[model samples]
Target: MTIYVNGRFLTQPTSGVQRFAREILTALDRELCQSPALRDRLGPIEVLVPQKVEAPGWRRFGLRHVPGGRGHLWEQGALWRASRDGVLVSLGNSGPLLHRAHVLCLHDANLWEIPQAYSARYRLWHRALRPRLARRAAALLTVSRHSATALAAQLHLAEDRFRIVANSAGHMLRLPSAPGVPARYGLTPGGYFLSVGNRSPNKNLRALIAAHAACGSKVPPLVLVGGEVPGIATQATAGGGRIKMLGRVPDGDLRGLYEGASAFVFAALHEGFGIPPLEAMQLGVPVICACSGAMPEVLGDAPLWFDPNDKGDIARAMRAFAHLESGKRSAMVHSGQKQAQRYCWRESARVLAQAVAGVPYQLPAGKQAARGVFGSESRPVENLF
Candidate 1:
C-alpha cells in the first residue's frame, strides 16, 4: 500500500501547524533514506498534492499532482480521490473526512479553547470536519499531552487516541544569522525583548502591551514581529514607540533578531506546543512565557513563567528578565538550550513512520519541541510559524 502525504499545507500561510507538516515530511524523507528497516517496511511513499503547489523537493517521497480545486474543496474532493488506495497522512488539522486510512496531527483545540480567535466559518468547518476526520483516521497525532487531552475532550475521543510526534528547533540552528537585521531595525544587541506571534485573540496582545507599558522604557524595548492588533498604535503611543511592531519577518532576519535579543517573551493564553519559545531557546535566548497552556509542560524549568491573564505578573517577568543577574541569565540560557535539544524532527519522523507502517516506536524523554524553519525558495513566508 502507498503512503500519501497531504500537501495542502504547501498552499497555506504557515502557522505552527504548517511548520509541523513541513518538518515532519523533511525528517521522514531523511528517515526513508537512512533507515533500511523503515524504508523496507514502508513501501512506496508519495505526496498527493494539488497541481498548483510548489511542493518541497524531496528525494524519497514522489510527488503526484491531482487536478482540482484549492483549499478544503481540493483536499476533500481531488486529493482524497487520488489517495484512496493508500493511507493518507494529513499533518495539519484539516484532511479528507471520507478517508478512513488516515493519520492526522491536530495541533490544538483552539476553536474550542479560544473561540474568539477564529471566524465563525473556520470554527464551524473545524468543528464539523475535525472530529469526523479524527474518528476515522488510522492514527491521531498531536504536539503535546495538553493538546491531546483538550482535543480528546473537544472531539469526544479517548485520550489514548492521540499520539505525540513532537516539534524541534534545528531549523533555527540551520540559518546563518543575518547581521544586517539589527542595523536595519536600529536595534542594539542584547537591548531588546522579542515576542513573535500573530495578533490573534489567544496571543493576548492587549494585556501583553499593557504589561510592556507598565514596565516602562527603563527596560529593553518590546519588539513584536507579526501582524498588528487593534489599538496597538494607541498602546504604543502611550509607551512612546517603546513597543515596536515590525510585522512578519523573514526566517534569516528572524534568526538574527532572536540571536540579538535580551530575552524572548510569549503571552499566549493557549497553545498545543508553543514553537516560538522553543525557537528562542535554540538561539540561546532565555524565554519568559505565560504559565498557561503548554508553556510549563513544554518549556519545563527553562523559562521564568508568568500568568498570561495577569498584566502585572507579565510586567514583573519582563522587568525580572531585564534586571536579571548575569549569572542567573546565563543559567536560563544553559537550561533552555538543553531543554530545546530534547526534541528532534528525526525522532518525530520515527514515530510518524511507525504509525504509518503499523509499528510501535519508543519516544526519547523530554517536553515537546522548528525553524528559523523554511524550505520553499520562490516565495517569502509571512505568517508567524
Candidate 2:
C-alpha cells in the first residue's frame, strides 16, 4: 500500500500536536530501515507538503508538493486531490472530510474536556468537525489510554476504535547540548528548578508562579523555559528575584536547560499526555509533575506529584524535591528513565504503518518492546563526576 502523509505540520510551530506528527513521521521513515520487509507493507510513501516550502527529506519516504495556498483551504482542496487515491495519513488531528480511507491522529479531547482553555472559534471547529472525521477515518490513533477514553466519549465513538501511539523522549537525546545556554540564562548546573513551558491558561502558570514564590530563596532559583509572557511578565519578578521566564527557545538551548536543572517542575493541567517531563527524564532529571489529566497515568510513579489546582500543594512538592538527598535523587532519576522508556516514537510509527497498510497489526521481530536506549547514556548533572 502507498501511504501519503499530511506533512502540513512541518510548516506549523512546534506545539504538542505538531511535535507528535513530526516525530512519528521521522520515526516511521527510520522504521523502514530497521525492518526492510516492512517496506513491502508500506512503500512509495510520499509526504505531501505545501508549495514553495522546503520539505523534510527522509531516506525512505518521498516528498511531493501540493500547490495552491496554505492552511485549511490548501488541506481541503490541494491536499485532498493529491492523496484521495491512497491511504492518507493525517497526523496533525485532521484530514479531508470526504476521504474514506484515512488515518486521523488526535492527541486529546482537551477542547471538550477543558472548554474554557480554547476560544469560541477553536472549540466550535473541533466540536463540529472531529466527530465526523473520527467516524469517516479508516483508523483512529491517540497518545494515551486516558485520551482514548476521553476522545471516544467526546466524539460519541467506541473506545475500542482508537489505537494508542504514545509520544517519547528519544528525540531529545539527538540534540547536542548548547554550551553557553546556562550562562546566557544566568543559570548554573544543579542550581535551578526547570519548569516546562506552555502559554495556555490550562497549563496553570499562575499557580506555578505562586508556588515558586512560596518556595522563597530556600530552594534553588526557579526558571520557566517557554510560555506566554504578557500577563505573567508583571509577576515575573514577584518571586523577589527567584523566578525567570525565558519565553520560547531553540531545541539545542532547551536540551541544555533540561541537562542543567536540579529538578524539572511541571504544573500543566488536562494534558493528553505530557511530553516535556519525559524529555527531562530522558536527560536524567528528577521530575515534579502535576497530578491531573493523563500525566499521572502516563508518568506512572516516575515523578513527585502535586495538585496543580493548589498553589500551596505545588510549593510543598517543590520543597520536598529540593530537600531530597543525593541517594533519593539518584533513585528518582533511575525510576524516571525507566518509566520514560515505555513509549517510543519508532514503536508508535510501526503501529501507524500497519494501520496505514490495512494489515492486521503484527509485532515485528526483535521489535517486541522498546528498550528505550535513547537515555541509556544519561546521569543526573550532579552525578556527572
Candidate 3:
C-alpha cells in the first residue's frame, strides 16, 4: 500500500511543530535512501498537500507532492479519500478524525494545559477537536515524555497509546551560518543573549523582559526572534531598547544568532519539546532555562535552570551566566554540545519507519543502550539513550 504524508504543515510557516514535521519527513526520506531493506518493506511515500500553498522544499527530499484540496476541508475530505489505498500519516496534530488508518502526531496538549497562551478561537477549536481526533487515531505520536504524560492525563488514554519520537538539532547543525548575518541585524557576534519562540503569554516573555531589566545594564542585550504577536509588544516596550524584537528571521540569520549568542535563554512555562535552546547548544552556545515542563527533561544538565515565574530568580540566573569565568563558560558549552548530541534526526526517522512497518517501535541505539524509550529523570540522555 502507498504511504501518504499529510502536507498541511507545508501551508503554515516554520514553527516548532512544523520544524519537527519537516525534519522528520526529510530524515525519513534520507533513511529510505540509505537503507534498501527498509524501503522495500514500507513501500513508496508521497506527499498530499494543498495546491494553493507553496511547497516548502519538498522537492529536495524526493517527495512526490500530489497537490489538491485547500485547508481543513482537504485534510478531512480529499486527504482522507486519497488514503483509501494507503496509510495516511498526519504528522502535525489535526487530521481526519474518522480515518482509522491515519497516524496522528499530537505535539502537545498546550491548549488544555495553558489556555491563556492561545487565542480564544484557537483554544476553542483545539479543545473541541483534538480529543476526538486522539480517540480515533490509528497510532498516536508525540514529541516528549512530558507531553505524552500531559496528553494522557487530558485525553484519558493509556501512556502506551502514544509513542515519543523526540526532535533533533541536526538540521540547524547542517545550516551554514553566514558570518555577516548577525551584523545584518546590527548584532555583534557573542554580544547578545538570545530567545526565540512565539510571543504568547505562556512563553513568559514578560518575565524574561523584567529579568533583563533587573540585570541593571550589566548583561548582554536580549534579542527576541519569533512571531511578533500583540501580547508581546507591550511587555517588550518596557525594555527601553535593551531588547531587540526581530520577528521571524531567515534560517541563515537564525543560525548566525545561535552561533553568535553568548547564551540562549528560554523561559517558556511549557513546551512539547523546546528546540531553540537545543539549537543553541548545537552551535556550542551555553543555555539558561526555566526548570519547568519538558525543558529540564529534554535539556538534562546542560542549562543553568531558573524559576520561570520569578523575575529575580531569572535575573540571578542571568547574572550567574554572565559572572561565569571563561573556563566555566567553555565547560557549559562543551556540556551543552554533549547533551545536544543525544538527539538525532535519523534516529527519529528509524522510529517512524518501525511505526510505518507495523513492527514494534524501538528508539535507535545511541552511545548508551540502557536508556528507556524516554529517558527518566534519574538517568541523563547520554546514559539512557
Candidate 4:
C-alpha cells in the first residue's frame, strides 16, 4: 500500500526534528533502491504537504503539495483527507488526531519529563495533544530505548506500543572537506571545544559555560553553536573571550566544525536520543557527553561522561579529556567510529518500512541478535535497537 508522509516537517526549520525527517526520507529512497522485497511489500512513498510554502528539501523526496490551509489547519484538513485510505507517517512530533492508520514518531517525552523547561503554551499544546495522538496512532516510533521507556511510563501505555528506531549521522558522513568553513569560524582542527543546541534550560548551556570558566584560560576556547544564545553573553564576554558564540550555521559548515574540534561537549540534561555525540563520533571526533538521559545508552562507552548538573564535574571531565594522551585519543576515536556505525539511516528506514508495511515488529539489525542488539532485554512485541 502507498504510504503518505505528513509534510508538516517540511515547513519547519532545520532543527533535530526536521533533520531526522529529511535524512530518513532520503535514506528511505535509497533503501527502496536496494531492496526489491521492500518494494513489493510497500508501494510508492509519497509526501503530502500544503502548497505556497517553501519546503527547502522537498525536491529530494517524493513531494506532493496540496493547496488549502497552513500549519495545523492544513494538517487537520487537507492532510487528514489525503491520508484517509493509506498509512500516514508523521516523522515529527505532531499529526492529525482523527487518523487511525497513522504512525507518529514522538522524539522524546521531554515535554512531560521536564515541563518547566518549555514555554507554557508549547507545553500545554503537547500535553493536550500527544496523549490523545499516542492512543489513536496505529503505532508509535521513537529514537531511543530510553525515550520509549520514558514515554510508555509517562503516557501509562504498554511499552510494546512503541518502537525504537534510532537516528543516524549519515548526512554528515563523507562530505566534501569544508576548508573555508573552518576559517570562517576562526577555528583550527583540534584547537577548540564545541557544543550545539538551542538555549533551552534543559540544554544546561549556563552550566556548560560555568564549567568552561572554571577550567581556566589554559583550556581551548569553548565554542557555542545553534541559533539561541540564552543568557551567556555577559559571562562569555567576561571570560576574556574564552567562549566563542558562532550562532546558527549552515549544514555544510557543520562537518568542518565537527572535524576541527578537539572534542565535542554535550551538556544537555535530557535528550530523547542524543544526536550530536553520534554526529561527532561519525566524523571521528572525540566526545564528552553528559551522563543523564540516553547518552549512556546511545553512545555506549565511546565518550567521556560527566554529570550535567554538576558544573565541577563537567569542568573536570573536559580537563581530563583535554589532557588525554594522543594514544588514548586515537583509541577513543576508533571506538567511537565503531559505535557510530551501529546506527544507519538506511537501517532506520527499513525498520520504518517494516512498520508501515504491517509486518510484525522487530529490532533493528546490528552487531548481534535483536536481544543483544537492544542490550539483552526483549519486549512483548519486539526489541528496538
Residue 127's lDDT within candidate 3 is 84
Ranked by TM-score, the better of candidates 2 and 4 is 2
Superposed Cα RMSD, model 4: 7.3
TM-score to true structure, per model:
0.89, 0.88, 0.88, 0.87
Best candidate, lDDT-wise? 1
Output the TM-score of candidate 3.
Answer: 0.88
Model 1 TM-score on a 0 to 1 scale: 0.89
Give the per-residue lDDT digits (tens) of candidate 3, residues 1-385.
5777888888787888889999998887766666655555566677877665555554323344444566677777888887656567888888886666667899987778778777776677778889999887768889999999999999999988888899999899778867677888898988999998877777889899989988977899999988844312223334347898888899988998888888999998888899988998988999999998888889999899999989999999999999899999999999999999999987887777656544112212332223222223322212211
Per-model root-mean-square deviation over C-alphas: 9.0, 8.8, 7.6, 7.3
Could you give candidate 1's per-residue lDDT for residues 34-121 as a string of tens digits? 7654554666788877766675777798887788987789999998899877677899888888876778889888878888777667
- List model 4 lDDT by residue over 348-374, tens digit each: 887786577552133123312222222
> What's the CA error at residue 207 for candidate 3, in Å?
1.0
Q: What is the lDDT of residue 337 in candidate 4?
A: 95
**Residue 155 displacement (Å), model 3:** 0.4
Candidate 3 residue 101 C-alpha distance from true site, Å: 0.5
| Candidate 2 segments exceeding 4 Å error | 178-180, 227-240, 359-385
Give me the displacement of residue 229 in model 1, in angstroms.
13
The lDDT for every candidate, in the order shown, is 0.80, 0.79, 0.79, 0.79
